[model samples]
Target: MPPSADPTVSVTLAEIARIAGVGRAAVSNWRRRHDSFPAPVGGTDTSPQFALSQVEEWLRRQGKLDEVGSRERLWPEFEALGDRDAMGRAIAVAGARLARLTDKEAGPDDSAGWLPGGTDLSDAQRSLVERAVGLAKKHGARDTFDFLLGRWLDTHVRQINVTPSPLAALMAEVAELSRGGEAGDVGTVLDPACGTGGLLLAAARQWAGTADVPASGAPLRLLGQDVDATQAALAAVRLLLAGRSPERESAWGVDVRAGNTLRADPHPDVRADVVLCNPPFNERDWGYEELATDARWTYGLPPRTEPELAWTQHALSRLAPGGTAVLLLPPGVASRRAGRRVRAGLLRSGVLRAVVALPPGSAPPHSVALHLWVLRAPAEGGTDAGAGVLLVDAADVQQEPSGGTQRAGRAAIDWPLLHRRVVSAVQELRTIQTTQTGQAPQTAQTTPAAPAGNADGDRPADHAVVPVIDLLDEEVDLTPARHVPKKATSANLGLRRSWNRFGTLLHELRDLTATLSALELSGEEPAGQGTVTVGDLLRAGALTMRAGQQPADGVVRTGDAPDDAVRVLTVADVLAGGRSSGWLTAPDASAGENAGGLTLTAPGEVVVVGAHRAFGAWVETDAPTVLGSQLYALRADPALLDPWFLAGCLRAPANARQAGTHASTSSRIDVRRLQVLRLPLDEQRRYGEAFRRLTAFERSLREAGTIGGKLVDGLTDGIAAGRLPGNRP
Candidate 1:
């Protein structure tokens, strides 16, 4: 079967640059300088789109077309169609061809109705399909299609709601842990809103990685449905390709269809052993009026504003007895006023087993931490109403610092640690359930009515096992934060580490002071070297400078921001000599830049305080950071200029005197006018190393002062309290 013809194709400047193996700036220059360049056929002035054929012809004339691979050339053509569904159809056609190549018994009519109108593909689309087949033959269909899908997802990420691969994998793992089974025992897995089949694929991979398949040879069934035809088609094709791969140890029966799971009920009577979902949030029109009387709302009628609850209930309705569902939902669904009735019902019925608050940026719309609600379809005539719900607050979990520019409070999720803690808590609850029910536990269930105690006799701050009756109050608030205690500070451990660091800093300070003392100064004045203004370096392309963005007052935030948020290097933070004091979401940081967003400060880039009397420059060695107000970030070409040397030069009083327009110290200095000493790269590096040492010496002094003060205060307080030996006052 062939996809319908798509005659026209258009491409953005970035795509043209990719096609020509050049930067986007080069493409822009070509458009501006060459009158013969193709005119914009579509799109706005800022992001103009050119006809693919015209661009291709031009590139051919320029001798750049030879650089593009056959498959690479097809992407722009696919984008030109400007229809996601049409591209999906073409991809499906390619998948079908690849499937037939691997499995000779697969009939030619396998993808007969996948394309629209049973029409033959246009020459351009046919070329794309053929190219895909060729690539698939070499790298394997699964890998080839995945590469293409990755590109597609990257392009339309903002438009499509995607479950990130990591999060999807975690969900699958958790579901498997709850279910306690080998692949053979799991009969079916269902995802109602299976966008691009991420969850389904994860489920398949998780199951395959577990124990060996049964000798019975019955394939694990993967069922999915989505509202978007194009996404559904893409998912179907992807699953089919994965299923046909020869390296797969276990068999998979994949059936993905295009239809609104909520509106049409595609798999109405089909109950699944496991259900995994990251359902759409805050949907106002999720069949509220017509489906008001729907039987799936077993808990209660979901408020119109509470679409996530509707999806949760639907998942429950489709679960086989003792089946488990793991759903990622917005945090609000746990405590919102409108969803309380349904939440209460779920808890009372013992269906809602656990609620885990994941760290922010764990899923889409990355500004807020999302919640995962672990659910179980009560076993036939077995409801653990007395059993407790587990509340795991893993929101504060972060990646252990790898000792570079990684800062404290950065929202990096420690996925492996989170997995272990969450799994342990759930396992303990399951054991409790088994003991109470007097039956062998086949799936994870709620804990016994009594709250479990730890070996140390202290409840862990990260998780809590609370009885359902305790959660049946008026609000029925199931927010994990509400139940789990705040993480306790390791004061003793922290104090010990701080004392160690203080000792190290003191040792370094002594060593550095001695090194500085040993420095011999020239007796006579030496001839001064020629100097160049920062503007001159810019013209010579030795360095590029960018000013810190003055984000709106409320935009620069502190405390519990998402993991994707950027650390904002502000003047105050620079002056105070500490880590970033504020954070900005990536989109907000990059909001108005024509080049797509704010450029982060790379390692060795120099960031200078642009205003204030204590003007200074520091070399950035931390992970990438976004610049905030009253700061200047300079990125020097290592071949032409040393970043540390440049930073040191900018910090000189002579440069400040020349660059500063006003006598007042608070006035901003003209960074472009700041002077740099001209020298060869090798000489610059020598000076750079000296400057680095000087900077470290100063930092050690500050650390020693701060630590010494804290240490002295602790000693004084201890003596005053008679906890330490001291002379009597």
Candidate 2:
């Protein structure tokens, strides 16, 4: 039986968008044309709401009642709604209903359902939701539903609005993995702000159901808390859907409710094994005078202008003496005027571990470059990790386009390479801890019996057991590279084991180069000159290209996009990193969007950076790699130059250096440069081989040294720690 109609279920433009799978603008149009919508139930200063029952019926009529989370219809509706205010009451009512539904207060269970509630369906509205969820079950689309719904609600509630910091994400994952060696199982991790709970989710997936994770729950623990209720509820649903709960048991202990770690504290005394977060960048809203005497400010008075400092202090206070934390912060936190004293204090205290300068792409489509701030408690009550700051320049990952007047785009993170590099660096640092302290422990052939004295002197036994300290250090500079070395510790050419891999790569590349040389020496080059300048080849359409840089460590270059995609690029990389200036007209903070040659790139399209128009730039790709699209993106081309081949061309010293001189404009380059300088087909192919060879050689050398250091680090450091798992004398 249908339940009583909801007269108060006010349907506003926003609510209509929420229910119709379209934007609010679409809802407004529907309201204008359809007379069935109930009269306005209530009104905000700028918007109005209608009966919930009427809204429900309208959704059913539109066939969108069962697909609330689908993004297919939402964008158009958003465009239609324009800037009109969404009636806030509609949201309040829906959220209240959702909360009640989630809590099982709407009614008793009426139908056998995945959701615990036996809530009865009232008006086709409830029926549609059930139907949509039911269809997801049929198609195995629950995860998508949950991800999108959570994102939508969070967007409205304003709890988790920030995007993920890719580099920061990589750092957190690496730190967690490294600790798995120390704790056996990384137990109980937490992220306070949680926003969309990316960190918490990443930590959970680390040892559960992921590529390397085992089936059963990991011995590791997970927890998250947020200040936004909608965000918290959304996170709760996400955690539940991810199989964190077993047979109705909770999946993780994450609460995305109200929580400002700096102001109102939750879980006050509990310490976590790992804490990963990217607190608000620079904040002035943080209360400065409220808690003048708070103990968390062990470093110095946190300036309200730099709220990131306060968050840093808060995260530090929460870590157990031996636990570790990785945070994403703006460059200002590392070397700003107002926060310098506090930053220095934390550094000198040996609480900071490393600082990594992330490339500009670190901020999703935004060009404001940031860094990773890694911190860990001292191992033996002392500040020195006994090492110099390991600095890393990642800006090169994001380089200028191949060529054109368009702006240079930021770089994308190569996660796999990044993960390996960071982990090996940390491990080498661990080895340092042992060497600075002394020698390794020795064990006898037979198992050593307990000492004559009581263990830990409980009741005065013969000898007491000594507790072991972990080998880890902290840095004064908040940058991840500061404590870590410029070269990968694993890349240590000085090591023997690493040399084996290095030698193999060297031999392989040398062999390949030799083969190419032989082919060249034979002169079997194409017969008819296969004449195909880029223009003729453009018609063939079978290639994709891109541009990149290996920027020096420490420099942070960012440019404004029409929208955050804009970037500062050299006329080298094919696709520019900037956004569509026509679309994102709002001027950015530093006035960069207009100040620079911001351009654009759509995902998966090929972009070519050439010396001249005839050959200056051309390429293609399908992935949404960033760029200021104005340069050049070849959509259907594979026979001419592959992606790897294209990347190599831009890396060539002669090609890159010479392209600038051939550039048409003072700041931007024209396509004519490459068209005349280099011909098509064979020569281009040769360039590709040469480029990949050098890159492969460079990689081989770097990887070999890194691998060797990683192998012997534990062995050599173990000799000093006495606790290094195996041999005892």
Candidate 3:
């Protein structure tokens, strides 16, 4: 029957470009230039598809295939299955095969027969199964599936969603910490909507890593449920592999059931010690009407529109006394009108322990930063719940120098640093919680409170301890940014140090002012100077404009060489005006070669943001960084244009207005259409120099303002604390 249709195992030109780690144009060039390149086996003229195997063979012949990972190699076959259900089943089957092999119950020859559904595997399915088995043998089943599942999700991120790995790790850490200093002990952990089981896997790994936890003892009990049967099956396989030991066939306690957790509780009687979940956001049809009277809505009946709140209550309901549940939720759920009463109830009962605001790009529906709701089931008579909620603004906790280009909105996070900060903050909050409850403080030294109440207690930077009574108002907004304490008391020595630095900055600012005054400038441009559109410059060869390509969600592979790491410059980096902000290592050469249409900036290239608030910057660094998507790079012909002058003109208000008019949407602008003054080369250089000096002056002003602000705050706190003289001159 037409060779069983070959499962339509083909990739489009764009996918080919990604596989090759080259621009689409480069792939097109290859098709035209190479006589032996694979022919299109399917698809339309506009988007031709080539057999994946044939293309890979061709790439391998060209020595361009080394960078492709095994996970990536299998992705095309999975996609060829055509339906997500089918794909999920195939993955589950592969996971089952791996599990069998790990248990020594199946040989390599029995892989196809080990498929979970008992269906005879097709040729394409068998090939995928073999590849998966190989990967499992090499990387272990849990890691192999993790890689495969990550690639699958990356390929269909818009269609399917899972918690980002770093966030899942953070949640797992918080959940463990909430066990109240019970070192090396992990009680039962549950994830209501486990998806591909990232959180559950994290919990299992955490338990395994604990030095004090005995590996020979009963394995950690892990319970999970998912609406998708395929996901639940995959989760079970992962747990089985993760918890498996040489002495045992499987982990002692692992129950991952298919079906909705909210609709049908698989482990209704089991109250978990920790509940960690990254629930789906903005789910509309969450059985609200049917479950309106369900007993789990102990806080309040979650509004029909607020399914996230339902998830919150579900998690809280599953918590044992003094058990903690950490849920990753949308920021809007904290302040949305529909969920206000539910939020208020949560606060009043003291179940909500802390709300930590993570930076954007932590997870999908990635339009805004997500919040972590750290909660505890109230003890009998509410004795365990603390008086105040810990609010931590961790949005700034991920600052790290990185290299490589990323998509406009997706900034790379320093997971290790962020995790440390988060863990430390949580520990600090625990200490504060203990102190507020009249228990002796464990971490920090404390003095008797001043009788006059002139000084505030010691507070961690970016964290606030707001009493529950204060949060029970009409608008119980738990946003960390809204409630962060404004001032912090400092020691006399620290205040003096800050004042000295402030004075130095003030002196520098004065010097900068004098330098700026010495520069001669005309109020208006020369009368005869004419303006030209950026389009004109392109046609005249004054500059070349290129838009950056949107990068795939994770790991860009280049070749077989393990050290092939590349840095990407992001829009955030461009805004920050120095150094690369993120980088990704190519898992293989094909992806590494594509670089997602990223162009390296030569000195004198100008980069401009293509969305939201439009701005531009001149490339000054000699180091190479790939241009991120959502930015347009303009490499000026040095003989005809000056980089700084072009950048300054592009960033001007008039050009921004011109760009706005040409915008397809209110937020997206075509930087190519911006207007520029057609000044002579020499004149442009002069303007460029002037712009450079102005930027320096602006930098000085910002420094002065920062130092001045810190000076005032330090002096004020010092005076109030009786550490500095209050007498004024």
Candidate 4:
């Protein structure tokens, strides 16, 4: 086996086969047969290393994880909490001695508690590890807890089983990369809803086994308190593994199952430098009635319908001034009016910074696009740097159709690309802050945005801060789209009349150009110059590419491929820029070739990128091609026109601005905005020559960006649109 010392960001297939005890060929066969097997993530030579998130998902699908011990199996001597209420029973059963169970030695009877049937964890602190796994399912949130507990028990428990070393290392490197207060400085890292030890471990690893933040006096402070003792114990195991021994590192604490994040108090006096969490979404009740007089609900009583608002407030409460948090939230949080008060409250409170969309299906079974709401507390004596929220809709990833349907059933989350986007967005946010506000980042300005007109026919108000307290007075629609103001767009972008006229004119122009090209090719004088549509270019041997087609059952990507990535070639990746930027891998070879054919992209080929907004734009490249189907890959006849020139013309201003904007689907993109007109050949060559280096530089910039492994586009968007992917938004 290869050593785990290499610091690359991806996993390999060979390692996957080894872990599953299947040959690489068998792995391939499995991928082909099982529609749900995750595709190859950041590839490694010896073993395929998947994003740790996806790895757990794979195990779940295979039913390989050990279910928690049955009540009878939990302990032979203890009585089952049969008639008692779940929460009350959980508290009674989990109290006191559960912490000491970590010391129990692994044995034949105890072995059953550790692994799934025969699959025990001698590698991990088996007894303790197994308890954490079941504790989450019994006491914590479902999906998130499953991943956290599963990974801790099955993967990271023992030194030998503690694999996927790349993710932990990469996370540390990423945190180091985001260094603001000098290296090795440690304050406290807080996770409000600490279900299992995963995030804390990630944070502990990031802090490099020590806490030494610049301003803080205490060096090693990692504070986390969860509502479940099993979770706390699980976190304890991880903290210990990362060198936070029980007796030695008592300065910081991890409390599990102490109290509700909303109602109870655990670590009420502590403040954190960084707060990271994936809080539960859209809960109907969070005990606002009991906490009616509580301090955390500062603005107003949280609506009985809004758990999201409560979580947001709780996160803000724990956040120290100038501290930053990356909160994973439901998409509706951005557009819902029911949560409007919280939305406006957060925006005006100098806490909200950036809202980014992740790819579809990043969360399994749920296809809504998830958003990362990056927030920060106001800094002392600094100007609030807040202005417009950085609204980035990057949910445009190449997705295979999930059958002509949107549901993925029981597939793993698309964590790789979503992770990449998180890394990219975080890097972008930090870079922007560091560059715009200097190393000592300024406190962003806080001002309530204008109140949105009520969807229920409430009188419209002029621009002003709408009190968060009053948001629940009406039908709650907390969606940002419902109230978040849209920058006025030209009629050309969203209006219908403009679309019709543009379409008619474009068709006439294309047909005319085609006629003129045929006449000129026949040596008959027709129009000003002989012209060929991208479609015509493909017929000639000099140019070739494919178009997109619908996906098979249980896939979540769209686009073409350059035969080698072994996908059905499609036109979706083809932009007006004439370059197929992304390619979709076939979930299985039997799905058939896309665009009705297979084609190869040898180096020096030209490709046209087509999307809902940008239609006629072009690009040329020697980059690897899995020719994405939305695009038209063009291999030009170099004798007549240079390949670079054609690709450059697609981006020319004089050309159509909206290329390939015909798509009506929300998950699949509308490329009309990128379309450009066909410029003169000489002009194309001149522009191409001038901008080639610039394009190369842009490509280099994206290439150099880090990967967080979470899919932001389809994964984030699919889940957020309030329906499964393929469902209309």
lDDT tens readout by residue for model 1, 332-375: 99999998999989987988888999887677777688999999
Model 2 alpha-carbon drift over 4 Å, by segment: 1-141, 150-169, 177-184, 207-220, 244-251, 379-389, 398-411, 438-729
How much lDDT does each candidate structure score?
Answer: 0.73, 0.48, 0.69, 0.45
Candidate 4 residue lDDT tens string, 1-729 = 111211222334433444454455665577669878775565332234454335445755697433443221222111122211222222222322233333332234332232111222232133333453455344432232333334334322221112123333333344443435644454777777765555566666566445222222344466666655445545553453344323443324443334566777577877777766666666567686787777886545567777766777777678677676666677877666566666666655656666656545443113566665666667767535443344444454323323111221222233344345445534554555556643433322122232375221121111112223333344433333333332222111223333444454455545545544454234564466454555445555645554434443333232212233432234443222223223334322222331123343456765544443434433533344344445555566666566676666555544443333334652233332333235565776765665565455443333223111122332344356444546664
Judging by TM-score, tell me the better candidate of 1 and 3: 1
Candidate with maximal TM-score: 1
Error of 4 at 663 (Å): 38
Q: Give the per-residue lDDT digits (tens) of candidate 3, residues 1-729.
A: 001123358987767776777666678789989999999997655457799878877887898765425555566778888777677777777776777665574455455342223435566676676677766766677677766666666556556677766778788888777657463456689999988788987887676543223454556788898887777777776666666655556553677877777888777887988899888888899999899999999989999999999999999999888888999999998888888899998887878888998876667755478899999998756546574787777775443322221222224555666676577678777767655756432323222233363322222336666777777788888888887743333244346655666676677767777877888878997787889888888999888887766455554422111133455666666556443545554332233334333455556678777765545555545534466677777888888888888887887766676677443454666676888887888999988887877766676676657657777876676567554455555
Better of 3 and 4 by TM-score: 3
Q: Residue 451 of model 4: what lDDT?
A: 38
Q: Number of the top candidate by lDDT? A: 1
Between candidates 1 and 4, the one scoring higher on lDDT is 1
Clashes, model 4: 179
lDDT for model 2, please: 0.48
List CA RMSD, all candidates.
8.0, 14.3, 7.7, 17.7
* Model 2: per-residue Cα lDDT over 1-729, one tens digit each: 223223544544654565555655566567678787656767642356566566666666767576333432222222222221121111222232332233243332232222212223333334334433433433333343453454354334322345453454575665664343543456667777776567777766654444233345454555666655434444544544454322333344444444666778765876877788767655577778897789889989887687888888888777776677888778767766677678667656767655666666556435555777677765546554334333344533433222211232323444444544455445544544545444432111111232465331111101111111211222223443333332222223224434555467667767766755565444474455432234444544544333333222222233323334333333433222223222221222112211122233454344555434323332323233323333455443445455445554433344435445543553333322332223365666666566556655554555545555666774565455454446567
In model 3, what lDDT does residue 255 have? 79
